[model samples]
Target chain A: MLALAFQLARRDLRSRYLGSFSGGAWALLQPLVQLAVYAFVFGYIFRQRLPGADAPGYVPFLVVVMWPWTAFAEAVSRGTTAIQDNASLIGKVALPRAALVLAPVMASFAIHGIGFLGLLLVMLLAGAGLAPAGLALMLPALALLFLFALGLALLLSALQVFVRDIAPALPQILMLWMFLSPVFYGRYVMPEWVRPWFDLNPMTGFAEYLRYALLNMPAPGLRAMACSVGAVVLVLALGLFAFRRLQRHFEDFL
Target chain B: MSVLVEAHGLGKSYPRVFRRSDRFRSLCSLLAGRASGEVTPVLQGIDLCVPRGQSLGLIGDNGAGKSTLLKLLTGVLTPTHGSVRVNGRVGALLELGAGFHPEYTGRDNIAMAATLQGFSADDLAARLADIVAFADIGRYIDEPVKHYSSGMVVRLGFAIVAATRPDLLITDEVLAVGDESFQKKCIRWMEDYLEQGGTLILVSHSMYHIQKLCRQALWLREGRMQASGDVFEVTQAYLAHHERKSAADEARARDLDAVRGLEFHVRAMRVNGEEAETLPAVEQGAALTVEATIASRDGRVPVVNVGFARADGTPVYGVSSDMDGVQPAPLPDGDFRIVLHIAELPLLPASYTIRVHPLDSEGLRLFDTVERTLTVKGRSSESGLVRLAHVWEHAAPLSRSRGE
Candidate 1:
């Protein structure tokens, strides 16, 4: 099953940019361009600043959280349509159906993860006040974020096969979710009452952990960590349950 | 012998989704772990057991659920009732392109298909050259699959399946798309595969191919198994049904009341002591006696002609009483009776019709005709409408094979 998933992911990645002139380079460049646009809008136009004089520049703060968020959002959105997109394949070939959903999530993470690593290396060399050791420290947090995205992906993709409303509505939902979390700004800037509530959104722990690890910022509270971990476990359980239950009937509906 | 495929009471049905709301309703029902409310059953109660090394042909008309059964056996569609158990690796070519991606090159799709068949990268690398050679599509291997002709697609699909060398091969009328040479190559390969104890399930409209490749056959009609047995019997029955169906369509156009007004018309005809329009199936080479009575309105003698034709209206032979220098015996009511008897019927096992026409005494002006359907039943695989008398001379026949 794992080998099948890997093969499908490779195919998905290659076919996505198959006809393009730049080919796979666009996987990294697209994220970079998105980052540049966000940087210009927030860093230059809005002049957004992090709290405290010692806090990292707004661009670095956004950079740390933005890439992981992009990976998560893209993984979920693409994965949601995975089963529907491969309706032809599912009806014709008898293989593990979950591998179809897993492929897109794996491809999204692989592409954005590389872009994130390259940008971090460039920043470290530019003397951007990044904790070089924190790069190593963030590996565990990154792994958890991947599971979180995968959990949601499995759930949404299965639902998309039946409902079909999930895919079209997912972008708006992710945008609202990003705003609710601390992707563009720090939880510290929110009012105190709302700051504590940020713990409920799973992305909060992921964003704050990246900032704390790479930018030498404050760590997420123990309650926030527990909440995010709990959410991931719960979502993973629900997602697996829903996906396994619905996978058998996918061909009938499709 | 070990059984390679077993299916019991297997059936399939599609959810009835006439409206958008029905799809939603079905989704809700399915998610709730309940059966959908409405469905159109396409197949039902199909029981099959194919032992290892057996080649079974699936023969049926269009929309008779042959393709659906193939998909069910291949595990592409889950059975709605009972179960199917296949104890070996199965490779299926269910449709034209075998589910290939149109945008991908043939080489790329080959790799993906091989992976789907559970071949590791190392295994595929070893067989890559063999697959390309078997497909024999030349430079089109590098072109996108959508750009390839339909025949080329089947060639590539069959080549990959051949490379896999699965334990059980299931194909659905895909060979009809290929050109003659490619088709011959596929048949040769399949024959070699079957020779090595491989199991096969084939679907084709061509009975010649079915009889040539399969030893056992199953005939499906309107989603039900019409007959299942030795290849010759089932295929011959399927063909006879079609022939009778077409002949009946033409028979409906001729009204008996209209023919009764003619000056010389056929009054009654009987085949082998049966007077019905469709006589019971007779064994090949059995004696056949055709008797006809013609009515003449002016008390004049009439010529009786007996003609044999395949049910599809292909005339086989015709003989007139006048041509043989014989006259029909006159009855008390001025009608004439003639009997034509064949001591050993030469007709092969298929559906045929015997027509008796009444003509004026000169045998030139035909008045009316009547046809009776005859079905010859046997296990013979001989081709053509009639068997010819021949003898083999100076033939060597002393060799014996170990398996036999």
Candidate 2:
């Protein structure tokens, strides 16, 4: 599965480059620029104080959260349409359909990793140097992030086969998710009572964990972690079932 | 003997249309707990087996389910009702440049395209040089493919595909991918593939290609296999049906002319000849012999002209007696079947129509007219609208025996 995922990732990146002049450098640059903008706005312009944040500045905090959010957002946005975009491939080849969802996940992961490294630098500049303890959580954090994106990608990609609107609607929804998840504001900033309502977001948990683990603060609430894992499994199981149901019908539609 | 692909009772279907925006509908339905609608059948009960080394031709009209069948047999689509079990590796070119990216360089695209076809980086590493050399667009192999000309794009595509050499190669009409030379190269490559015992199934429109390459042909009509057997047998059926349809159209034109009103006092019309006129047989590519006449209503003019037409009411060509650079002298009264003469008639006959119109003095219409047909029948080298004199040669002669 990983081998296939890598092949599809290579194809996915190549197509992004092929279809546009900027190539994949543009993809890497877009998020980098987004980070810079947020840094300018929050770290310099606003210079808002972090209450318990030995975390240095807010944008680096925002960067860590936004990077993963972008991955999840871009994965579902592009991944749902992956099968639709490669209708020629879907129409002609007998491929393991999971590759469609996995391809975008890998591509998003590659770009997001660059943002992660950039976040590391910004945090260091903002007076928060990495601790060995903070570094240890990276893999688990990435895995949880990966699982969350993969599950949603699979579900939306399958639904896209039957209903194409998922491909376009995802980005708008992702933007909505960004504001809701604490990319610009922490979930803790919400009231104690409404915080539970915000915890319904699997991503709210993942982003809070990035803030906590990377900044020497507390991780996302335990309930959010539990719910996020459940959401991944649920999305994956239901996505596969929908994919299996729609798999036989795709050629005719193409 | 190698058996590369087998499909038994394979089928697939799709709903005629879900609204293009059905994603929103599906989301709405999902949130509301409703199931999606049922599917409509597209392919029903198809059984086909392609042995190694044989090229199978699939010919059908649009919507005959040819593309759908190719998808099912190649495993791009699973059968809704049955099974498809393929042996060894399979390559399907259901569409050319299936996963190509416009922004990527040719080399990068090739690497990515091969990987999508289940190739590993190592596999591509081994074949990369050969694929590049085969594509033959120097220097531009590293440039983005969007800059490549259409012809160049096809070269890159065919290069990657030809390098694969799978156990089974299933291709749609996408082989019409390049120029004539490339098309010929593709066919030659397929012939060589067959020579080496690779199995190939091709869906094509060219009867010439089907006859030359396929030992057997499957004819599909409206999504069901109409006939499957020797290539010659099935092609003959397709051609015969086409001829019958055109003939019925010719018969309808003849009946319409019987009721046309012309200013001339009386008579009938037709092109070259059908029910009313016949000419002496001439060599192929000779001018047509013509015949049509009009009786005088009041001796206004002796102007007569005949038009040659195809079965569908289209004129083949026309000429008139009035063009001596001036109208023919006015006619005196006499009932006449005008025998307009030509030295040669250049037509390959299935059926032809001649519309005979009568003009009065000053080239004005005042009375009656007619449209008719000319049916030419005989075994001739010429089969379409035009006839040609051609050469025939035989390499060997065989003796015939009375007893089997």
- Which predicted model would earn the best TM-score? 1
lDDT of 1 by residue, B232-320 (tens): 88998899888877766667555777887778888889998889988999999999999998888887889889999998888999999
Tens digits of lDDT, candidate 2, B1-404 = 56667777877766445566554554445434454345677777778877777678899887899988887777777777778888877777776655666777898888777766778888899999999987888999999887988778878877887898888887888877678887888888877777777777889887677766777788888777888887766765565455546656545333334433334644545344634444332344455544555666454555666676765555677766666444433334454555565555666544555666666655555344465545544334333566555666875655532111
DockQ of every candidate: 0.62, 0.29
For candidate 2, what TM-score does chain B get against the true chain B? 0.61
Residue B181 shift from truth in candidate 1, angstroms: 0.9
Tens digit of per-residue lDDT, candidate 1, span A202-237: 888888999999999899998888988998899899
Worst ten-residue run, lDDT, model 1 chain B?
B395-404
Please give the distance, in angstroms, between residue B188's alpha carbon in candidate 1 and its true position after superposition.
0.8
- lDDT, model 1, position A85: 93
> What proportion of the real contacts between chains A and B does each prediction keep?
0.57, 0.57
Clashing pairs in 1: none
Candidate 1: misplaced stretches above 4 Å? A48-57, A125-129, B252-268, B293-302, B328-338, B358-361, B364-370, B390-404
What lDDT does the true structure give each of the candidates? 0.88, 0.69
Off by over 4 Å in 2: A14-33, A36-60, A92-94, A121-127, A182-190, A195-200, A219-221, A251-254, B18-41, B137-140, B147-150, B251-404
Worst 10 residues of 2 chain B by lDDT: B252-261
